[model samples]
Target chain A: MRFTSLSGLALGLALSSTAAFAGEIVLNSDQSDPAPKKAMEELIANFQAANPGITVKWNNFDHEGYKSAINNFLKANPPDVAAWYAGNRMAPQVKAGLFEDVTDVWEKNGLNDQLKSAAPSMTIDGKKWGVPYTYYQWGIYYRPDVFKANGVNVPKNWAELVAACAKLKAAGIAPFAIGSSQKWPTGGWFDYMDLRVNGYQFHMDLTGGKVAWTDPKVKAVFDKWAELVKPGYYIENAAALDWQDAIPQFASGKAAMYLMGNFAVAPMMKAGLKEDQLDFMQFPEITAGIPMAEDAPTDTFHIPSGAKNKDDAKKFLAFVASADAQTKLNATLGQLPVNSGSAKPDDKFLKAGFAMLSSAAGLAQFFDRDAPAEMASAGMDGFQEFMVHPDHQDAILARLEAVRAKAYK
Target chain B: MSAIAAQPDAPLAASWWKRNQLQLAPWLFLAPGIFAFAVYVMIPIVQSVSLSFYEWDGLTPDAKWVGFGNYTELWTDPDFWTSLRNNVAWLVMYLLAVPAGLAVALFLNQNVTGIRVYKSLFFFPFVISQVVVGLMFRWFYAPNFGLLSGVIKTLTGSNIAILADDRYATYGIIAAGLWPQIAYCMILYLTGLNNINSEQVEAARMDGARGWKLLWNIILPQLAPATFIAVVVTVIGALRSFDLVSIMTKGGPYGSTRVLSYYMYEKALSEYGFRMGYGAAIAVVLFLIMMVFITYFILQMLRQERDA
Candidate 1:
């Protein structure tokens, strides 16, 4: 036994990498876009500076590929720190014991107070699995110039929103521009509709698979969605276009409003819409006296269970969760910092989003993030199907119900 | 031989090698190839078959054994049925490449000026990668701004999004796949046409065989080998149709364009997919379908060997 242990120690020593060495931590993330990439680099540089003698090695991946790749690397070649989304999206990893519980870090850093807005999403079974640093509000990012051109007013309720859509359609403009080729854009639409129609708790319950998809409350949400979809208010052929592709239609005044996250504002500006032309609005109220919960999908960081340098990773998470660090990071990211003490950026869209989100009754992560992956995948497809063929609503809802029945088990 | 074996200097290794070398040499030559096929193909197939009986997320340390539960699920799964139907469509439509390829080969097989340039241009699609082909066709069929849509608009005065529309998405991707597949088939036929007996053709022509009759009687029988290969490859291509669908639509617009391979990927490996057992079930079904055709091809080859 002694000889075997000696050999094992020798092998372990030889196999250990530089990143596994004391005072070094490895981070794996998908901040591959220019702005996020830049923000990540700054955060790393700052982290290393603050903790002298410690170094950070980051492996940045492109966004889409990382979602699938994370599964392999987390188990096979785990980094000390990993970036992921908050809420039920992380449930599988948490449940499977892949993510290290950072509840201690939350307790020590008093993040429960500083990051209270995102606490519920970060929690699973009364324990925090990750520390969320940033989130962007999902709402109506529209062209006010197009609304004015068509003599339309801002919609504040379900009736007004439908009326506005009709007027925009009459003026030869698609009321909504949705590029749903990726299907997640449709998820955003569903989240808003559900949150507005049935309130956050029911939406969460439905997404959590506790509520049947065939429930009347669920049908009511679809009914509200159908009002916009069946009236030819949305751009035609949305299923083939990507979210970015729909931006051109909105920017060119072909479509007046886009229901998307605030990340869309940068692309809208790049598409040549001026600040005055671009505007943000909360999704109109559907059911009266249902406290308007908003969708604020949070981005987070976690330590893999297999990580060697746990202490340094915890430090990194604490640093990331701080108000000052978040202020600088979200400024560069053009998003709202999760930390309540962090100064909100003065960007016109961010300012509006921060105010709206702060005053909101509650928050839910976007549909794809809030639901279990299997349910989210099927549910989003069902949403797109219903949008294209409203007459097949019963069929689509039944299919989703069946998927829910199987998926949760 | 007994005296030599008894000699002290006679090596045991040398004699043993001499005795068995004739039989062992072929196996030695085949060792690397056999090892590669076993490692890369055979092992994975076995593992996938085993995995189909277990529920795995492809990440967890333990996978739950579910017996034939995955297969039963696939049996009732509507998406599986849709994928199977689309694959059938692909198989039937993709076979048209063989005749289309032959027509192009016949058209290009002549002594004419700048013929090499025309031949190269005709062979262009196959030379480029499948990814580039999918992208080009995606652009061509894009709704408001695509070239085909523009033409269709002027002629019919109706906007059509081919890739988004369920009725057209599968056909659009199939058309994209056929562009390069036809080229590959043409190359095979062109080679077969070159090796045809010129003297026999002349003799046939002298006997008043001409045009369709002469070509049918003399030329087609000679190109049977090429036709066999073309059909084999086309069927395989049709069965494994994943890339074009992935790049163009990702089996989207409510999963209307999902083939079995793409569906398996979606269920097993893609961003939202984690059901390894279910994916393996889909893969097993696809493999069985391929096996039916593969068996026929192998039997045909064996019969031809007997004939020869």
Candidate 2:
């Protein structure tokens, strides 16, 4: 098989010299940041330089537009390599056989040993499907200046956090800056609350359908969230704003804290806040003896089954998995590298965030990413409704149960 | 036959090409248009209808025929019912655009300074995309900082999150949708108004038919074609309203805004996993509902064609 494969490659090279190249191999991505786009262009330039016979073309769209366009593109001009989310988000596409399996490449490149923890999420059954580039943890971003002015410190536990919020409120500052209009922001609050109140195992069990949504452990998280909402700790008019738009309240000192992912840092800086002025802390402990966990959603790259250049795609994937590539990508994008031995920045906030996530015994993919999308849509809406009127817990639970039954089937 | 036989040796023989050219020329002219429409529109409609009976995620090689299982599921789904009810509300409320448009058209139809500028400005909303219109409305409905909320607060000391409240969310979005819809209707009416019979108006004036009677008796009948087109477009727009709902609320605040289109998208795509069969089922239901209105319109058009 090896001898035939080598000869076949040589024959193809000979034939290509006499014939015109087939066409351009297109690469599509949802990452719209200028830095990543430039890095990708550089990587493609390197690939084209190494492989002189093949040409590469590129198309990029933002997250929302990319989601809609992917299906259309798959049926029409499917790209060779595309960036997509992992876990249940990619399950449907994987099941449809839309992606190429690179298990052989995974072993050859030794990514299996390097990314042991990240490998399962990228695998369906026992087949490797994608190569991960970067992942980051989510936590509460707070103002150090507000904490200093109010004489409040970062809370280490659930009770201490409640007390800190009280102190902030007493000083006429909103304690939490949440925007529920986008619907998905409210989901992060639910996921963190569930993880802290129950445990990481329980969250997995509930999402995996082993435990029902109406279980008492899940109910307690909503109960606690309602308690927080009853008080005026969150910013006013949160229901009418997007998560990014809510940053103004924090920047202007109207709110003291925000629950967001690491991607939010760029927007915060764009809103005119310096890094020294802000900090991050994990969600406070809800269950006394339960181990700590953090939410880490990683972005990965996958090769479609229709790719004309499988060998080149594998080479690119192997190149992306290297420590140097991970570090360069994360440093340029302000995200944490998934590579274990990559060098990190010296900033206090990122260092503290790294320390917190490293110490965690488990990791929870964020709510929207963890649950199936159908369930998340209905589930997040229920969370928003419960936020407005906590007394409708029974009604909310019933509706979620109905949605879950249909979604899981 | 005798004429052909007599002309066999004459200069005026009827060739086969000449005899058939009249019949084939019309089809030749229509072939490209018909082929394009069949490929883009008719084929997709038929495929969606057939897929509605099957259970297959779009990626699977084979689809399982499940009869009316998709429709059966839709019948029991409360979200589907809610979306259908909202569609009914959108349809009824959207009709207000016809009269409202005519009123504006009449108001701006006068010969005054910069009247053309006023007309163009009034027609602006129709030209912008629905996504932009949704964003503008979202900003206007933002609770504390929105323009409408500010005005209401100054007058009534209360703030309403229009898009967040279940009761008002759909209505608020529909009103935003109506802004462009009304502009479109106004353009159609303005064109119709340009061609109204001036002789009839003058005769009505001699007969002392003025005010409401004069306008209703002499003008409105002539505007029937414009009104018919406006109502048809409005009904179709109301049914196909997925973008605004997806952008504004994503069928949220407790799934109160989950229209059938967004609901189908959530089921088939997104993180929901590929329930292609289920999504196709929802699409079939929506298509059937639209087909009812389309059939009625087609019948009406056929009657008008025969009369003409």
Fraction of the real A/B interface contacts present in each candidate? 0.77, 0.58
Q: Identify the leading candidate in terms of DockQ.
A: 1
True contacts kept of 1: 0.77
- lDDT string for model 2 (B1-308, tens) is 98888776564455565778899899999999999999999999898888889888777588889999888888887778888888888888888888899899988878999999999999999999999999999989988788998998999998888888888999998999899998999999999999999998999899999988987988899999998999999989888989899878877666787787888887777544367878888888888899999999999999999999
Q: TM-score for model 1? A: 0.95
Classify candidate 2 by CAPRI docking class: acceptable
Worst 10 residues of 2 chain B by lDDT: B8-17
lDDT of 2 by residue, A1-409 (tens): 9999999999998898744464456788977766567667766676666557557777888866787577657656778888887777777678778888889878997888877768878889799899888887789999999999999988988888888999999999999998888778888888788888888988887777677778887788887887688886788767767887799989888898999988788778777788777888888887898888888887888888888777667777777777777776677677777777678856565677788888887877677767876777778878888878788888888878887886776
RMSD of each: 4.8, 4.5
Docking quality tier of model 1: medium
Backbone clash total, candidate 1: 0
TM-score of candidate 2 relative to the true fold: 0.90
How much is the TM-score of the A chain of model 1?
Answer: 0.93
DockQ of 1: 0.70
